[model samples]
Target chain A: MLEMSQVSYQVGEKWLLDSISLCIQPGEMLALLGQNGAGKSTLLKVLSGECRPASGAVTLSGQTLQTLSTNRLAKQRAVLPQKSRLNFPFKVLQVAMMGRSPYRGERYQASAEVVYDALKATGTAHLSERVFTTLSGGEQQRVHLARVLAQIWSPSEDNQARYLLLDEPTSALDLIHQHSVLEVARKFAREAHVGVLAILHDLNLAAYYADRVAILRNGKMLCQGEPFHVLTPATIYQAFGAIVKVMRHPERERSPLVVWTDQTESQSIKTGKRSVSQGINKSA
Target chain B: MLTSIQMHNSPGGTSCEAMREITATHRSENVDAASSVAHVVSSRRWSFGIGLFVLLVVVAVAALGVGAVSISPGEIISILVDSLGFPLAGPLDSAYQQIITSIRFPRVALAVLVGAGLAISGAAMQGLFRNPLADPALIGISSGAALAAVAVIVLGATLLSGYTAFWGIYALPVAAFLGGLVTTFLVYQFSNFNGRTSVSTMLLAGIAINALTIAVTGLLTYMANDEQLRTLTFWSMGSLGGASWDELRVAAPILLLSIVLIPLQASALNALLLGESEALHLGYNLERVKRGLIVLVALCVGVSVSFTGIIGFIGLITPHLLRLSIGPDHRFLLPFSALLGASLLLASDLLARTFVSPAELPIGIITSLVGGPFFLWLLLRQRRRGESW
Candidate 1:
């Protein structure tokens, strides 16, 4: 298990994460949802040991995160940031091979096999030989996802649990790729017993794929539970400041679909005032 | 899905259309062709290494034989073998042996070492900064060394007479090396904030340091005597005519150490191309790697500048050309940069001496004249291919 207990991170007088506690079990996918500045990325960073919390602790398996060597920590966890600024023309295979750096002196063929498997898992195997910079943004995102997957491709020799942390992994992807990437994460969680934490913007994607969902509002946990229980209309409005309606998915029972409702248009019809476009025209 | 509909309705739809066009074109290309290209890329790395080694050997030998008192290749080989305590079949000319061993040999050897040092340092700097245009000069190493060289030249007989007497011929290079290291340290310190080094801040700091050092050097030049000024001019323009066995004894080991050590960070540099945070997350101790690289660069470049003055473009262009040919894997790039850099400097030194025979043009002039046009052509080719720098 990867656990964060009462972690608070502050910059000057402002708190980016306020006493947040969360845990992700192996063989489970947890989706983190929040508005901009709600500290979703901060929470991920703290958990990944990129930043030290002002108070409290993050533990991987049973060991405190700070006490672990970077190489040891790397073998057990991998992080994929929202944007990758790789300008060099490295081949995709070479990029993926970098994931196996933590396992230094391992046979080249062994690492290559792991990397190839990771590329296949992320549906990027065919693009392995292509220059990474020439790939489309969505393709690049998937390739990065593959790289992280290859990092923890196998359980460590000590049998410690592995974790994967992704920040907005699907933002650059298309609809199909968004689902496919999440599906790969879900498969990894289920089959490989990896703990997967993904920060997601699409509530419906989270509803369909994640085992549980957690929402943050103003650096505080607004709610956390099964997606069906936590993704309520009132919770969505409270977390994002946008009115939304939550309904059951027609195809999948117990899964919720969230649709944003325009308050201006609805209120205009009720009060017999100008429509949204007319308001825009008046402002212009 | 509702999300897909909203995405289409959003203002990003135009970019989405463009992205689809790109994807369509990409899908049309053969996947097998890409795999085959990858196979060729991996195989070509070794072949390229061998080819560069052969090229360096040929260039070095040709350079050794093409001086004012031209010795034939066979005689050059015989002289070299005789010096190594292996007497060849023919009688070796003592004068030819003396010239080759005492004069041209050290000069050529220094050229190779200085070239490799500058080139490998340049490769490492480019990788560290993650900027293709970065070189040793970008960090003010060359300018700082120049300032110290100028200072020693101007002050060697006056206020610094005691200091010069203490070190004798070693005074100038030692001062220059210390100067370069100090300037680099200041730049690094200025850019480091809250335990993180901002590469942009480092670049800006480097610019500021370069301007200050160059101004100081100019002041020193204004204060110099005519003889001092003449020496400074030749030094600044760069030359191998002053090369001697004693100077090579000091520079060779330092340059060789740098050439060997810089490539050991190949994996870290490769990871760094992804970005600093990415490299840290990949299990590298980022701070240690950055500091080590800075020190190694300062050591090699400071020594080279101390000995040869500011020989430009070798460090900047060699790794770049190699990257275009073999990709930017530093494991290959660093060593190849060293080999190619040595070959280029040897050839440039050969031209510098022979082109205007008996009255040598500065080797720095030759490198810039050749490297400048070649670099511009590379940029043009890259632009034509629709590749971004």
Candidate 2:
């Protein structure tokens, strides 16, 4: 389990993240939702040791995060940061092989079989021959997924509890791949008992997938609970300043759908001649 | 997850099983010229075998013949054989034999050693910085040595007027060595962050340090009296004019140590190409590796600068030229750069002597004149392709 108690971060003179408290249980899929400046990345960084909270602490499996050595921390918790840019023509296999970095002992060379298995698991087998830099964003994300999986490679042992932290894993993904990637993560969490914390942009996707949701507005959590409890229209309005309707997904039985308020306003606009008034009301 | 079968697709140029590239970089356009060129060029190990092999033989032969009174290569060999107490047909003249054995042999050896040292230092610095443009002089190491040499030149005889001027010549290389170390240490300090040297920062710091060293060298030059100024100028411009057996005692060891250390760093340089984080992942402790390289380069450069002043370009040009022909994998690049550097410097030194004949041109001048254009060409070519290095 990963637990953060009143974790906060200040950079320069401003607080990037204020006092935030949350707990992520093993096998749980926690979706992090926030605006552009909502400290979503900062929150993940604090948990991952890329940043330290100004006050309070994040503890993993009762061991304090601040005290764990870098290599040890890497082995236990794997983070897949968003890709900005890479300046190499690193082959896809080489890029994927880097995931095994933390596991290397004195002469650490990850076994070929282990790398092959991780590649197989992530279904990036076809891209093995492709250069990493040449791949499209979605393909790159899967490659990154393979890398992360290889980083936490376990031969047969299940005793090792793992933490997988992803920063906006599905942002650039197409709709089908989005669901496919999330389903893979969901399976990894339940079967592997890997705790997952992902920062997400799509609220409906978060509601459909996350076991629990934590919504942040301006660096502080606005609400945190089960998706059914936290996906209300009022909270969405308070967080986003836009009215939206919450309903069960028509296809997925347990999934939640958040239809925007503009849909309703446009429907009324279609019935009446005064579309300009409707646009004004919607803008307001 | 790349399947087992597909993982071997992009063949790594430098795996543990890495061997010499049999891949010919140049096109076989006009196969006869290329073939004849290859046929005459000695072997595939061009820099290691051909360049050094030919230079050694030519230097050995030329050194025997180049004194005030020339001796034929055959007569010089006879003199050497006569001196060993193995009688030759007609006994070799004593004075001519002494001049050849004592004066000329050591000077030629010193020339080779200094040339080798400067070239290897340049190549190592290039690899360490991951920039083909960096040379020994680029880091202020040469100026550091020049300052030390100038100080010893100007003040040593005046301060200890009792001592013979003979000992004063040794002061410059010694002072230069210390100065070089200090400058490299400072360069390492300014550029290091989180125990890893940032190559870009290191290059920038090298520029700043080089500027400071130039200012200091100028100050020392300004303070020198006419006689001392003359001595300092000769030292500053660089030469094999001061070559002697005694100087080789120190230069040879330092040169040998660097030659041994640099080739070992090939793998480290290869890893550095992937950037620091990835290299660390590859199990290299970057800080230690960088510190070792800096010290090695400084030591070699300091020794070379002390004796020969600063020969430019051998470090920068040799590595880059070798890379154009051999490609950038450090396994081949490092050793080839060292060999090519030595051959280039020695050949240039030979030109510096023969070009002017009686009035010798400093080897440093020749290198800079050649190096500056080559440097500009490399910059332009890289700019045309985008200078990623």
Which candidate comes out best when scored by DockQ? Answer: 1
**Candidate No. with top lDDT:** 1
Q: Per-candidate DockQ versus the true complex? A: 0.29, 0.07
Model 2, residue B235: distance off in Å is 4.4
Model 2: CA > 4 A from native: A1-9, A17-33, A37-251, A254-284, B1-136, B139-141, B148-209, B244-246, B249-300, B322-340, B386-389
Worst lDDT 10-window in candidate 2 chain B: B13-22
Instruction: Write down the lDDT of every candidate, Cα atoms only.
Output: 0.85, 0.70
**Pairs of residues at least 3 apart in sequence or in different chains that clash in candidate 2:** A119-B1
lDDT of 1 by residue, B207-258 (tens): 9999999889888999998998888887677888889999999999988998
For residues A73-176, write the lDDT of model 2, one tens digit per residue.
Answer: 66667777765334334456656666766655433233344455555555564566576657888878877776776666552233657788888988777665
Task: Encode model 2's per-residue lDDT on B2-96: one tens digit a residue.
Answer: 13222442353111111111122322332333234334432564544466567666776676577467888888888778878897887668888
Each candidate's interface RMSD (Å, one decimal) is: 7.9, 14.0
